[model samples]
Target: MPSRSCPRLALLALAATLALASPPAARACSVCGCGDPQLDASDPAAASGRFRLQLASEYLSMDAGTEGAPGSTDHLKQVSLRADAVWSPAEWLSLLARVPYVRKDLTTTGPGAQGPGSSLSGLGDAELGARITLLSRVDLGRGRSHGLALTGGASLPTGSNDARRGGERLDEHGQLGTGSFGPYAGLHYAFSQGDWYAFASVTGRFHTVNGFGYQYGEALLWTAEAQYRLGQRVAVSLGLDGREAWADLDHGLAVESTGGLVLAASPAAYLSVGGGMWLGVRAQLPFYARLRGEQSVGPVLVGGVQYQAL
Candidate 1:
């Protein structure tokens, strides 16, 4: 039988997973850029749990820089609803999948614009992946442990690539999907000593050209955080997350303003509501952004719930 004390570790893992998985939907650029892969320190082999589910929502609003025309208003607001599932079939391995529903509103300030804004809602790209624990150590008497794992996955082009508004074709960046497949790989490490925990990871996503002869830039994503368990039912964390990307390619030509670097401060809290359920919220405030050409970025807010089913 799995230990009921697992909720403490389960809550930590839930908060960590939510923080890592929410950023990909928060970007204001053409490509989804970068975000953390879904993996954490919870040890299923240690009698934590065998299966879990998470539901989360992410929100971001951004304004474009004045590059094309004077007195032009280009702003974007996006909200994503994501459902993630994790299954631990073996002690050393975990399999996961994610599905997303996206809604976007783009408002432009310009002459001859179609209405005040355009809105689109649809299913986004879905992902499938696994995590392999490479090493695990535990000291039962000291209540200290650490683990290292390898994580990788791919995103499927399940959403529509070509979307039109007012009979006008939307730009690739404005489309609901990339229309191409993406593969990603990363490494994760976590350490816990008593009520204090630390985590870090780096992931890279490789992009391919779509049928439209457009390829999004490859992205590098990373995160580092520290969490403190206040008691059996509460925890708080603070960390830094960031991304770097190469310029995107369009018909073998680099697209201007398509790639850059962004770094943010993340603070989060989690609470156990009892019966294997946990609630968490995180805020990502971009303190630094440097983009090519004319582009701007904004903060992201995320909230979610996790349930341990098995």
Candidate 2:
């Protein structure tokens, strides 16, 4: 009887050990909206749902001089903070919201010297939108996938337009808040492997200015990015962006382009650190810039954090 009891106890212990050694299922990839498309489709873990949040900040400064004052020049500085959250309900559906806070200051000198002057404050504008993946990897081919996403949304007028205008009247084009309805759209494509990823997308927005007197017609924007995994926990990317804006008021339209490199390190599977730069065209132009022969260019720095909830 003692020998029979010992055999039963040994069997139970072996079964428990096997169960503890099995790995947990992989959580979905909510950060990119579309899961890693480069992985095998038969893997159940690749189709799971995920939630993501991201926060980013940027700083920019520009200075220009005129021939009359020779040494005299004008300068502007701007700081921006942005946050985004997204929920993936299905492999083909996602909802997103974004908020932005901005601060700006301007200084000028020459004949009418007003001494050095500055204004520092916030300009409020927040946006909400939804995105749908019309096509997934399954629709493309076996082992290969392509995703099509369409986003629609609006920006709420929340920033103060009168924060620091100094004594000079604010131009409608210079005000921070549009005080009117704005619409935007985006399209994206991604190709993924077990852990590597590449993507490209284009986004556009149309703005109808409010009583403040600015006219922002329609703008076209586009971006392309490629990324590779350094190991199981790190990924780095390079990207380029281009934009053309049409002004309805005095500042006509301006064309700007930017290119940058991004470095992202995932200490854990769900958290990441990212930083990049915008090395290209930066400008504020009067509608008829081409006619006036005026152009502005500069560089910007950007940094951010991303968190995903499994």
Candidate 3:
């Protein structure tokens, strides 16, 4: 209950929140940090109850595979508006909520996009979550710190899953949501010294079968990032991410090309603007992909503007 303990406790909660939030893996699905978390970090105007809003444009495209495969290649071009609010009602706890609006166009190549394609434009699944400070930071002089935290949350099935065009069902991948609820848990650890900082996190998400009696499989995601602050307004981050996914199931049958493991690298830059505002851009590229079948993964580009203390 001491006045100085509040900021240290908030720093502990941040350790967990920043772990899985900076550059999520490319195939993390429900566990990806598609919204920016560090968007309004450490703004003097943001004493408590900080809010960060990010609107980003993201794009990803796949490659064509061999013939006779059950699925064909597809490319996704999307524009999404994501909003994240961070409220520190108590020093030892924080509440977070994220909502996104996605407009994605799927273009099929070869046989896949020719028939099983559909456009999705609507509200994506919204997530409500909270972070607890398991370990508060010890703020030594000269800005040295260490902290840890834990996070738990769930996603609501707000997006439509049964989207059809001309009486044909679109692919599950193209749907705005899985039509199923999911739960997420994660842990974070971070260390910072002066202008240099590093963080790591492990996150897991499990999903249930959707309305079509199909499940997209569970995912375990890992992330690590090293960053350096430039002057007072700029930060550069280099991140590595990995994901392991179980094979998807449909009608109790395993989907061959549905799951595997992927490793990716991402780099980002953030520029702080005056009045608790910032701008950022990041790219996620999969360098190693060992999928189950003939599936492939690609890169994602995200550009966003964020605000805090609002």
Candidate 4:
């Protein structure tokens, strides 16, 4: 006879494994929401449900040094906590908001290093957006469907931009916000048949000059993922993420080491914890990078809890 406790034990084991084995990663760029927007589940947005709420955390570590230089010297670590909410008052439209808290620490080495490093923690930029379903085809009986959505949003200049260390203002990269508004637009598509699902998205973020006459680079991001449901409670996903950023501008001059292209492979798992709740973890491993200048990027890890009602 099948034990009643078997399912419960499996759930606990999977949860524990994910918590312990997950590393540091993120769903998007470290400073911007430049990639996938869904969290903790596959195709939740496909339902056009009433509301969804998610809380997520991400970690990343970076090391920087001179290009071709024998040894790297500077290191940076970042942690972010975010809250995302979506309200779908109608079947075709959904309004969304995202808010984040960020903590950063930089460590410098070598003779040129300045006083060890700098650290800052505070609120990051907030985003408000809306998603409109442009196309939808449903087959409830056969469990097959197709969905297409258009997403548009803007990032508010709400976080600190003039953070300082030892009386010197931190650079734009070190601050929590850009102090300038950022606008983004994207398209998302999803297809589901039986227990298999696939998703793809393309997004672009545009930036403007800040108070200090510094402008961060504009970015283009894309993602594609395939998910397989393991029975009713568990799902696994594999995906590819790609990003390309234009060079930054300093008072109208190109800033080196500020933009590049990166491609990564992501593997993720999600589990339904009952009562409309789901838990998920994803790891992004960069397999290729073509940076314009001397800088080293690192892997990112992210985990989240989500609740939704349909």
Candidate 1 error regions (>4 Å): 1-10, 13-35, 39-49, 65-73, 111-115
Q: What is the TM-score of each candidate against the true structure?
A: 0.88, 0.63, 0.82, 0.84
Candidate lDDT scores, in order, read: 0.70, 0.40, 0.60, 0.66
Report the alpha-carbon TM-score of model 1 versus the true structure.
Answer: 0.88
Candidate 3 per-residue lDDT, tens place, 9-67, comes to 22222221222232222223333342223322322122345555545555555432322
lDDT of each residue in 22-138, candidate 2, tens digit only: 010100000011111111111111123756555656555544342224445445566767666656667666665666676756565666335555555564466667666767664
Ranking by lDDT: 1, 4, 3, 2
Give the per-residue lDDT of model 4 (tens digit) for 1-310.
1222222222211221111111222211454432454322223342345676777788877665522233535567878888877777777787877788889887667665667577889998887887788998988787677889887878889999999877998756667888888887888887776556777888788877889998877888777877766766776778787778787787898765657777878787878777767788778788887776666667778788777666
Error of 4 at 244 (Å): 0.9
Give candidate 2's whole-model lDDT: 0.40
In terms of lDDT, which candidate is strongest?
Answer: 1
Q: What are the per-residue Cα lDDT tens digits for candidate 1 across 3-26?
A: 334335435545424434333322
- Pairs with backbone N, CA or C atoms under 3 Å apart (clashes), candidate 3: 108-113
**Cα lDDT for residue 157, model 1?**
92
